[model samples]
Target: MLGAHDSTRDAGRAQRWAARLAWPLLGIVISLGLWALAARYISDVEVIRAAFAPQAGLKALVHLLGSGELWPHISTSLQRIAIALLLAMAIGVPLGLCLGLSPLFARISGPTFQFLRMVSPLSWMPLAVMALGVGEAPVVFLLSFATVWPIMLNTAAGVAALDPAWMRLAQSLSATRWETIARVVLPGCISHILTGFRLAVGIGWIVLVPAEMLGVSSGMGYFVLDTRDRLAYDELMAGIVVIGGLGFALDWLARTISSRWTQRGKQG
Candidate 1:
């Protein structure tokens, strides 16, 4: 009976995996078919074909990979993103904890945060350039600024939602302020923090494309513009594909980390 149950579970898992992958594959096939049809029938097929044809774009992507021309752009973009995320986490987590712990502070600063957060990151481009100058600094600043809000808000909510009994228990045990926070608050709110981090990564990556277009010479965004200027439409499309694929990979990694943390919390 146990063996039969195990077999059934394995079969169910396999079925789920099949469905998960099958739908995306089907969608890709349908989309590629439509793309090819458009390339075949469009009035300006010659002009559009280089950009629209998946084969051409794939060929360009392969060429770029083989030639090693894309590595610098990829490295620069990834480096900026990593640094921005780390900066956001460093500022946001501490600020969030403070806001969560102190109602008075939250009341004082909440409106200001809301106002600042409402402003689009792009709107600050001129100011960032003027202040930070034409370089990686402004791009990193924009990415960090855009990502910080989600992490901060989610962390604050998580801290607020932690069980009051945990705090009381810590107090009863004569735990120090730091001890209570380190032991009770941080652990209890880790799931929320991870969720926030996942969300921030997605938002940050989306912002990063435009952020890179700002005065920086080497990044995916610059590559896109460079390809366009050089009339390498296929390479432009290939660069776009590279950006999308990298963003998807980053999001997947963030999701995996969040899932693992959630499962660990459940087990604990």
Candidate 2:
């Protein structure tokens, strides 16, 4: 009797999940249909010298995967993003902490940081290339430049939002400056830091393709350019799909981590 009841409960739960997923599945179907239509329309264009329909894209993607041609590009792109984010975090976290902790420093640097943030990271391409030279250095610099602002801003905001009571408790405990920041401030800012990191990842990924185009030989960005120049439009489309998938995965991972950390912090 208990076994039958548990089976029934599982079936009901499965049905509920299917119902919840129905609209999203429908949306995916609609999007695929639209993409197919667009490919068909592009095929009919006389001047478009590429056979890049949905079929071509699927074939190219499959070929790329089967031949292991996509792996290197994917790895390169991931590596650059990882390095750039680490560099951004290293720089942004300290700067952000300073801004949050010192009123005088914040006042002095606020306008400068804002002005710098307002400038497009791509605009630094020439200088980055010139100063850092071509290859991965320039690409990493550009991505880090684009990614750092959000992290710094978010960290600072998190610090600023911290309760005075926490600070008082730290001081009351005779926590040193480093101890106060390490324990009280940084812990409190974990959620904000994660939020900023999430934003930074988005920004970095968006800038990555263009940054990779500078002088790097391998990456998704370079793959796009190669496919374009070779008139391999289907491969280009496949590359686009890969990029989107990777970005979505990264964003999902970041959100998951952030949520878990936030929940843990709250519970603690």
Give the top-scoring candidate (TM-score).
Answer: 2
Q: Model 1 segments beyond 4 Å from truth?
A: 1-17, 37-45
Q: How many residue pairs of model 2 clash at the backbone? A: 0
- Write model 1 residue lDDT over 1-268, tens digit each, in one string: 9999999999999999999999999998998788778767755657776565889888899999999999999999999999999999999998899889999999999999999999999889999999999999999999999999998998999999999999999999999999988999988898888889999999998999888889989999899889989988789878988999999999999999999888887887
lDDT of each: 0.91, 0.92
| TM match of model 2 to true structure | 0.96
Q: What is the lDDT of residue 185 in candidate 2?
A: 98
lDDT of 1 at 37: 83
Writing each residue's lDDT as its tens digit, candidate 2 over 44-131 gives: 6644534566667778899999999999999999999999999999999999999999999999999999999999999999999889
Q: Which clashing pairs does model 1 show? A: none
> lDDT value for candidate 1?
0.91
Taking every candidate in turn, the Cα RMSD to the unseen true structure, in Å, is: 2.6, 1.6
